[model samples]
Target: MFGLQACAKAPTAAADAAKPAAAAQDDGGYPLVTDVRLQNAGNDDGWLMYRRDYGSSGYAPFDTVNAGNVAQLKQAWDYTSEFDMGHEAPPVVNGDYMFITTPKNHLLAFQASTGKLLWKYEHDLSNAGLKTVCCDVVNRGVALYQDKVYMATLDNHVVALDAKTGKVAWNEKIHEQDVGYAMTLAPLVVKGKVIVGVSGGEYGARGYVTALDAATGKEAWKQHTIPMPDEPGGDTWPKGAAETGGGAAWLTGSYDAETDTLFWGVGNPGPWLATLRPGDNLYTDSVIAMDPATGKIKWHYQYTPNDTWDYDGTNETVFTDIDYKGAKHKAIVSASRNGWFYAIDRTDGKLIYAEKFATATSVTGPDANGKMQTDPALRPTVDKEVFTCPSFLGGKNWWPISVSPQTGLAYVPTLHSCMTIKGAEVSYKAGLPFLGESFLVKRDPAFPNQWGSVQAIDVNTGKQAWTFPSELPWNSGMLSTAGGLLFSGSADGYLYAFDAKTGKVLWKSPQMTSGVLGVPSTWKVGGKQYVGVWAGWGGASPIWGGEMAQDPKVKGIPLGGHLYVFSL
Candidate 1:
């Protein structure tokens, strides 16, 4: 077993005074991140959000570190955080400062070029019920706007910090921490509002997305992921199940500037066994399109209605234009947890194409209207066990997929595993897990010796273009570049750069201290381009997927919190 490193001490006043005067001058006069700024973020100098842009393109336009010269890449700098738990937050880069959050809600800022500690803000959450968090204690990342950096905390609060200094400008509580409500998703700044979602789907917490005033920490609007009795799609839920019906919007969502709509994916329903909740359970496993200004649902598409297999639709949704049926269509594509890759019309929430991205035996395919045609025999029952493909983690999870306009393919980080699920009786408790099912996950025999894959799918045809396999389940999110490089980290601790056109591995780094689970980001500072990713491993996989986590294939991987930056 790997030992945990001692936490790094916070910089003292004397160390701050000894810094060079030019450190402050490094601010590059970055403009306020508005809708226009987010739309053009691919060409921007810094990584601004979770997926680096509002459309969630995850493509960096910088070309200084191309495939030809990527072999010469070296570690420019690294920062080890204090916490040893999951360090999944993608470093948010602005002008000169880069911001990141770690376990226990510790936020740190560093010099973008030198990795110098700027400041740290440790939030006090003594009253929070940390045990209620279903997965490992983790924060996805942060959002940046005018001069304030927005982050959702694990204790159900949204905080705005001064980007220059790590001081809190305002803090507002969004939900009660002890009631199975927490925030793990990065707050997204959409049209001057900080939009965030809640976690605790396992605890039967009713999920919702709330928009807070960016300038002030006041609530602007709130939209429940589960519908009320009088609302649309309400009849899908049982008489009173909507009160605790889980539809957590826990992953960062994407935006469409052209339509002024926000596309957010919803998670699974509570009491994991569908037999307990009954009905279709509206909005739980669905993608909702809402007006960013008013938080009104324009339309929604449910990926897994009556989801019995614990398939959550909280994966990131990528918005792009694709040629569908010999015509160009604005599409929202998702590698769904139910093992299907779907391309829906972003303008009207109509399915343009749907196909399997992973092995899923429970469903034959989509029906004429795109609803999943679930195999009733494969559904779990109270008295018997049912085998299902893709496990509960789905074909993918919160780890993001990148849609590269350069290659016209969506690079998906996928897992090839299945589960045997058995249902049981479960009672709802405020701060306890409401899961009514037990599952054991294992790698599918068809994919022997391979549990992870980075698949490049052609968006136009909804087919796999190429695939790169890994021995362990891939946990890292993807970052694509115009320089013909696709970057993804692995559970084995190596950050790999693959040729975007083909799945050939161009360059890979020596194994680091821990596995790489965080998303990768790229930015340019001082005329030099750098790629950065967090190296730490601990998420839902280790906590929930027992067999896969303890598999001898990945026993060599370690757990530690370190940010690695590489440059050519």
Candidate 2:
């Protein structure tokens, strides 16, 4: 049996936003992205942030080119990252300049209209940094604010660089690089705060989210995921392991400007076993709403308590307003790694409803709060191996799901995979991927021939609308336009558009040399609308490339590193 731990004190807020004095930096507050971050303010440009906005809907309201002329979209230009790995960064376009980050942490500013390299910034990441990265070695993307671009390095340092000159400005060490912690998600800027989360929950590091003074590089606040004795969540952890309890806050978060709340998704608990440290871990594998001004958690809902299958709830918690039972309510939706689609009241973190979108047997019914009811038998034992429906990689990984408010549904690229899990005694050693033992298993048994799929789900009804199977698993992030069409890339190097109502493939073209893995973006440039995506194959699939390599369909497809922009 797992030992229930004591909780820690609720993490404290560091900065006082009520101070009327001017910031120490030259500017009173952080500058806004005049040409980029707010580009969609009717100027007709490109996507600025991961998930398009703080909402993480991956939906752009622009619909200049709809289903009729989408077929005419041809390649506008292609820019190569040259470093390869996985080109997962989405390009942010301002006027004519497009900013992108490579997997190796090289920041580049390119000509959006013509594929011309303007400037590239490369950080001297320590060799030690390379060794501690637990997953794919790459940076997800960058955040553009004021006239500077902010990026968190694999070495756990958040560095601010001149957006135009590509020159380093102020740099601060956010976390120790030797602790197996890193940053891969794009930094989110809310009001004047630059918010970022740590990665390495799988590697046994404490998970937390930090807010920094965007202009002065001053520490604003820090919120720990797990709790220690005397803390609000201290009672949720084992007696003494709360400090080391893993609850990594990865991926970007959602912002509710009306309520001044920031909603971020938290990753799995440490050690990969419930028996190691028991009790419902406070914030692990949960969606938490925090006060951006003070970093105090307003409310939280744990998606998977004492998670043993590694089903992280750290995907985008997309903000959307829906009519429930005839009344309109603000809501946030997430397709968690636990293989369930959930809708919650964004205002107070109350469970509205949840349904399994995949073949999940770990949970039977909904808890009183509407969360999936977990089967106690699914929890791993010291000497027993348990096979779960969706493996540690999750039914849905980091791929951003596209939500069409027009159709009131979300289109997701779901993975039909499972991991054969077995827990072992593990010890946390700084600077190494923490875990005692590993497992080897097949992903999908029923449809071994199919690994990936694009499924349309009705957010209002909690039912799958349509399913479009992919030859390979883990396609790419999705982008939906007002054109009544959904755009996404596949591991087969094909960029496709499917009818939003019905899962029908309307058009597809070979845009990348290898399988595509990054999210897709659409924008209007030169009076013509264009769709864009980074083409590179890297992620957990490639990390377990040996298992994926056996699939004949994705067998010969090489990895690619380039950005393809299409316009009609």
Candidate 3:
């Protein structure tokens, strides 16, 4: 047995709206999931995946709770997780059961309509995985296939659980923990294959995404993000540099079902020192579009070439159709840690528009080839310390961006910060951090008083619509809806709803147990739409936010986790 039935909490929120959801649950169980259903998550009633759809839009087409009645939103129910390190998992819903993962790979199942606990599966972990975790011990969430719930554990094992009984179906070890590889991504399942990536770029692990048979848990194919000595990108690096070149695909990627393509973002190159290996690193700090069936690279677009500031391109690439300059485009966008909001033509992987969404001052040009030109002087060096905007924590880190097709704007969870960085000498070890750079996170010089913002950008125009400033880093993931509402959370402990069009605060929930670091999601049950988000303060924020983390305002905030659901 992978799990022992857990105890439930009191004061459950009755599903007054369960009448409409009766049609969804066949036999009073989770609705049978299919590839077509996962592709149509935008039109569904449950928060299905990390972004709710293949596009990673994080937008739901529910209007029952719109901007008009948002102010009346109240807590429907809440659940406290077993572990409190970082509840970074969003509530992945299917029928009446919702799922979340706390730090340390503990999976919690819940009654979606109420706050009752269903079952909790505590993953068995070896101590080695915790040694090389670059950030906190966090698991993003889980993926639900036909009947199995899948999660990648911190020890690099992908476990498939019976969605109903919480029993272990199969557990596959993706990689050895001793080599410094770990799995924190929520598995992405499509066409019967579970796709997941590894995290250990800082530990010199060459990154890759593997596809497994969803039902059997057998390996299908694996494609590495960093190329080898004989590969096409071999010439881009020095001799043998590709061995630990560092292009970890650390986050869950977005998919385009129509194109049969998988878009995965590659992280920063090894050592964070351009002088170690020359040329534009082929896929590091780039987005690679691959064939889902074979894991073959179809097209790739580099965001920051020769990245030396730890500016990872490993942020989610969200798909949203947009009208740009009087022409409609099938576009994919990303709010990168480099502090740039980029809109790309998904069809051919070309840059449509790239605009600065936060404090960014290290690089400038994307030339005609869609390549970023790095500012040589601003880059950190062995002997020179350089101050740059959007620090390594990023203008935005792994916290996701949400795009609303209704408004044609991307709601960006942003960090208004900068850093002073310098290069350091590093040697590759089997299971050690290889970040050959030193950085001290600081406030953005342009906005000295503010550390973060909810930046809404017009995707079509590559222009800013509005921004909501914050006293602390707004590291929570964002959600947009057909309700004309934008939802996100704050480091100061409030879950906020803003008018998507004008950046106006529609509702702000009372302070929760801790800071909101998990992504916000929306699902409909009993015809009533509920907003779900987890609260916890562990990520790269407090761990890597140097000077800023020590500030009186950010220091000693809190450290715990809780799940909150709100409905009007």
Q: Give the count of colliding residue pairs in each prediction.
A: 0, 21, 1
Candidate 1: misplaced stretches above 4 Å? 1-35
Residues 1-568 of candidate 2: C-alpha lDDT, one tens digit per residue = 1111122123243211111122122242222364234433222355667777777888877777677777777777776557657777777765455678888678887656565666788877856546767667777787767667888878887888876567888888888775768888889887667889999886788899999988877889999887777889889887767766778887989887778799999988887777887788888889999999878988898888777777787999987887767767788989988888888999988888788887776756576756556888876776878777776666788888988888898988898877677778788776666565466546668657677799998888668999999768865888887888899888878789888888788888654576788888876545556677887877777676346556666666676587787777
Q: Order the candidates by TM-score, highest first — what do you get?
A: 3, 1, 2
lDDT of 3 at 271: 73
Ten residues in a row with the worst lDDT in model 1? 14-23
Q: What is the C-alpha lDDT of each candidate?
A: 0.85, 0.75, 0.85
Q: Give me the runs in candidate 2 sitting further than 4 Å from their true place.
A: 1-44
The clash number for model 2 is: 21
Error of 1 at 262 (Å): 0.7
- Please tell me which model should have the higher lDDT, number 2 or number 3: 3
Per-residue CA lDDT of model 3 for 1-568, tens digit only, reads 0111122236446322232232344454557677877888777788888889999998899999898899898788887666657667889987777888889998888778777777889988756648888788999999988777999988888999987779999999888886778889898998999999998888888889899999998999999998887887767778888888889898998888888999999999887878888888778999999999999999898889888888888999999888888888999999898988899999999898888888788978578777777788897778889999878888889999999888889988888888899988888888988877888988788988988889899999878899998988888999999999999988878889999999999899887768888888988776778898988888887888898889887876677777888888
**Per-residue alpha-carbon lDDT of model 1 for 1-568, expressed as tens digits?**
3333333334333212112222222243434555566666666787878898888888888789998999998887788877667778887886557888888888888877777787888889887769887788899889988778888988899999887777789999988787888888898888889999999888899999999999999999999999978999888888889998999889989888888899999999997889887788879889999999888999998888899888899888898899977999999899988889999999999889888999988867778867767888988888989878989988988889999898999999999999999988889989988989988998787798888899999999999999998888998999999889999998878889999999899998767778888888998776688888888988888777768888975766777888888887
Q: Estimate each model's TM-score.
A: 0.95, 0.91, 0.96
Better of 1 and 2 by lDDT: 1
